[model samples]
Target chain A: MSWFGNSEPEPPSGPSPMDLAKQEVDMYSDLFTKMSGLCFKKCVVKMHGESDLNVGEMSCVDRCVSKYMEAQEKVGVILKRAEESLAAQQGGVGGPAAGGVPGVPGR
Target chain B: MTPVQQQDFLQHLESQQRKDSLAMYNNLVFRCFDECSKSFRSKRLDDGETKCINVCAEKFIKLTSRVALRFQDIQQQKAKDEAAGVQR
Candidate 1:
């Protein structure tokens, strides 16, 4: 007896677009978390000796967080410029060209 | 396109986009980690190392973009020269 009638339908080939976007967001969040952890270790020089945290250490942590975010933004800008140039060279209307305009709102 | 075919195409596009984003993230992590981990003997980041890592990330991005743009300029110039030569 053949088992063909008992076979289940194949699962979707891949994740949906919304699922993909969520995954991308999660991946970026994870990356930022890792960077923050590293930055915290760097910025927090002295342990408070007790459970209480010191203002100096807290300030440093804040600076580190801002710096990390700035770095990410810088990298993003570089990538965006590269993509824009690449798109311009390729003569494609999409890619970076669609999103890359100077002094544009919501960019 | 049929509904099933459209869904399949969308799925494929989503997967590719995810893969590309992952690759970008990996590249970033690698670059940042390498810069940040230079003084990794103590398993903690030093003040100097932190500063270095921050500067490194910024400079790396700048350098990458500059090189890419320079290469593109050269290619464009070469193409222009070739066209001029052909005209001559």
Candidate 2:
């Protein structure tokens, strides 16, 4: 959609899907870095030495990161399913009601 | 307004739209945090705690869908009831 009455920008010339996926991963990693930092600090109360975390502490951080990723994936799946079911209920096979066609069951 | 003034106004509007999109993203993150970090009892998350967060997210979306459907059902039923009443 055009914003502020500006014309739509041209599509990127380079690898679009890869670029988009990389961008998404970067955003998620930024979020994960913040969350994992907090969790790591809490779990790794005492560092063995400079730049050293014990096995338990390291494991905790690993698990925390994994869990965060899993949570993100789960949220994505949940939203996708909700959209699909709502679409079905609205008379589309697996998404929101399509445009056009009267008395097609979608309001 | 002059052409330059119009251009500036459009740029400002675009910036505001970007801010709004960022705010929407932040709100989603906050929602996820609420579902994931409900309790801070221990420094380390228990075995099932992470799983709970995933489950919570899934259930929350499902609940949202159900609520929406229920609302639509109620509206349909109400309309049907009103039509019957009118027919009577």
Candidate 3:
């Protein structure tokens, strides 16, 4: 259905835009797998019956996803600040250093 | 597209994907630690922990949008200065 329609015409014979979209999906799939493995280790202490996921586990998973999104936003903010300061310095604008250096996430 | 063109396009996408994946990985680690790994005694998140996770997420998003607005201001200022210089 015309999802990623661009002004440029479709190439007659090369890797289509669909391939690019597939790559994006693959990247996100990898991210989901890693995030799930990490949260599972951190939150699922007990099996607690044979229902696959207990109530506590389910709640923790929900929180975990929300927290991860938050962390991404925080990191993005910090990164942009850092970039700006670096640019300012290069431009001789003498901008102040980034405030409250945000810690690197995930490692 | 020619073989060279296709290779270049794929290379660009790969680099962008790599950067995104790394950022996601880092954010997940930090957020999980902040939200769920406070106490090692239990794997289950307590109500407090659950609340903390939600709040932490919200706060970070707020901070990000604020910073983005500030960055936009700088970009506009830069553009204005460049335009004035060109007119001179």
Highest lDDT against the true fold, candidate: 3
CAPRI-wise, candidate 3 is: incorrect
Stretch of 10 with least lDDT, candidate 2 chain B: B59-68
Candidate by candidate, in order, the iRMS in Å equals 18.7, 18.3, 14.2
Residues B1-88 of candidate 1: C-alpha lDDT, one tens digit per residue:
4697567656855776577556645665676666466554797888766666566555434333333343345435545655575589
Question: Which pairs, if any, clash in model 2?
Answer: A87-A95
In model 3, the runs with Cα more than 4 Å from the true position are A1-27, A92-107, B1-88
lDDT for each residue of candidate 2 in A17-107, tens digit (9 for 90 to 100): 3333333334433453455444533444431233344466555655655555456556656666677777778887534322211111212
Models ranked on lDDT: 3, 1, 2
Provide the lDDT at B5 for model 1.
Answer: 59
Candidate 2 residues lying further than 4 Å off, grouped into runs, are: A1-19, A46-51, A89-107, B1-88
Winner on TM-score between 1 and 2 is 1
DockQ of each: 0.03, 0.02, 0.04
Q: What is the lDDT of residue B32 in candidate 1?
A: 62
Worst 10 residues of 1 chain A by lDDT: A1-10
lDDT of 2 by residue, B1-88 (tens): 4686566555655665566446545644565455456467888766565665455444334333333343345436545655575589
Ranking by DockQ: 3, 1, 2
Q: What's the distance in Å from true for residue A33, model 3? A: 2.8
